[model samples]
Target: MIIQAVAHRGYPKKYAENTLSSFLKAVELGFSHLELDVHLSKDGIPVVIHDHTLDRMTNGTGRVVDYTASELQSFRVKQDEHIPTLEEVLRALKGKIQLNIELKQMGDYYPELEKRVLEVIEAFDMLDQVVITSFDFDALERIRQLSRDVRIGLITFGGSKAILDWSLEMGATFLSMHYAFVTEHYIQRCQDLGIQLMAWTINESSVMKQFQEYPSVWICTDELEGFMDVLEMSGSI
Candidate 1:
C-alpha cells in the first residue's frame, strides 16, 4: 500500500504553518494526519507553532513563551494569518484528521509543557486522536503517566540501536525521526517489533521514492501535498 502522509506543521508550503487555515487545508487535501509543534504561550496556553522564537514564522520577534496568547495573536503569521490557539486548530480539524503534536522542549519546561498540552487535548476530548512526540523522554514519560489513551512517539534526530531499545521499553506507538534515518533494515526491524516508523522534514522527489519502497515509512513534511500529487501522477507511490 501507500505511506500515510502527515503534513508537517500543516503544509507550510501551501498555507502559513501551524495556523487553523493551514491545518484545514491539509485535511481538505485528504491528509489523514497533520503534524504540528506545540509550545506554551506566555500565559501557559498551548499554542501551535514550530519555533521557540517568533522571529521566523510571525511578525513579532521574541521567544514564544515570552508572549502571552493575547500578545501572540497581535503578531500574524506570514500572509496575514493569526496564530490560532491550539484549541481553535483542534476544533477546526476535529473528526477530520489525527494530530501529531511535537513538544519542542526549551530547557526545563517539560512538566509545564506536558501539563498545558494535556489540558487542551482534554478540553477538546481528542486525547484519542493525538500522538504526542518529544525528544525529551522525561517529558514523554511524564505525558505517558498523565494519559494512558493518548499515543506517544519518541522523537529522534538520529538513529541508533540504543534509542530503539529504549523506545520499545517506553511503549512508544511510533518512532519519529529525521528523514536520513529511514531505511529498509530499519523498516524491517520495526515490523518485527510491531512499531510504525515516521520520518520528518522530507522534501525531495528521490527521497520520496526511497520511502515509497517501504510502506511502513510514514512521513511528515512541509511539501507533503505537492509530493503526493507527484506520486499520484507517476503512479509510483
Candidate 2:
C-alpha cells in the first residue's frame, strides 16, 4: 500500500485544528487520512477535542467533560469555529478520508469511551473508515476486547520489542509512533509482521526526508503543501 498524507489536527496554524473547516481544508488538499483527538463530553458523548482542558482550544472555562455536548457546541473553538461533534466530522469526512481517532480517556473515563466511540462509528457504517489509537494500551485492549471488528492502533511515547509484542497480542493492525523510536529494523519488523507503521506530528522537512529515504513509512504531517512539494521534488509522494 502507498503511504498517505494525513492532516495533523487539521492544518492547525491557519485554521481551527479539529474543527469541521480545518478538516475540510485538508480534504480539499487531497489528504486522505486525518489524525484527530476524541474526549468524552459531560453526557458521555464523544466529542473531537485535543485537550483534556478546554482553555487553550476553546472559549470554554474548564475541562471537556465539564461541559455538555450542547454547551460545548456553542462555545467558540480556536478562530471562532464551533466545537464539532464526532458525527459531524464523520459526515464531513465521509468518503473523503480515513480517520485516525486518538482516544484520550484518563482516570476512570474509559468506561463508556469504548462503547460511545464504537457506537458512533458503527452508526455511521464506517467500520473501515475509522482507526482507534491511544497511548494507553489498556484502552486499546478494552476497545479490542469489545469486538473483533474495529481496527486498533498503538500510539506510544516509546517502543521496544516487548511493546511490539504487546501490540500484536492486543490485535493492533498498525503502530503510530514517534519518529525517534522508528528505524529501519523496526520498520522491517513491522513489515515482516504484517503491520503498518505510521509516524505522527512530523511538520518539518528534515523528518520527511528521513521517512522518504525509508520504504513504506507513513508520515502524518501538518505542512501539507510543503510536504507534497518535497515529495514531488524527490519523487517520493
Candidate 1 — worst ten consecutive residues by lDDT sum? 106-115
**Best prediction by TM-score:** 2
Model 1, residue 5: C-alpha shift (Å): 0.6
Candidate 2 lDDT over residue span 1-237, tens digit each: 223777888878678889898888888888878899998888988899888888998777888888899998988886469888898889888888889999996646646887898889999999999899888877888899887889998887566898779877877888898888787898899988878888877888888887887757788888878887887888765
Pairs of residues at least 3 apart in sequence or in different chains that clash in candidate 2: none
lDDT of 1 by residue, 59-102 (tens): 78988888889999888888589887788888888888988898
Candidate-wise lDDT, in order: 0.81, 0.83
| Model 2 / residue 76 / CA error / Å | 0.3
lDDT (C-alpha) at residue 120 in model 2: 91
TM-score of 2: 0.95
> Given candidate 1, what's the lDDT at residue 140?
85
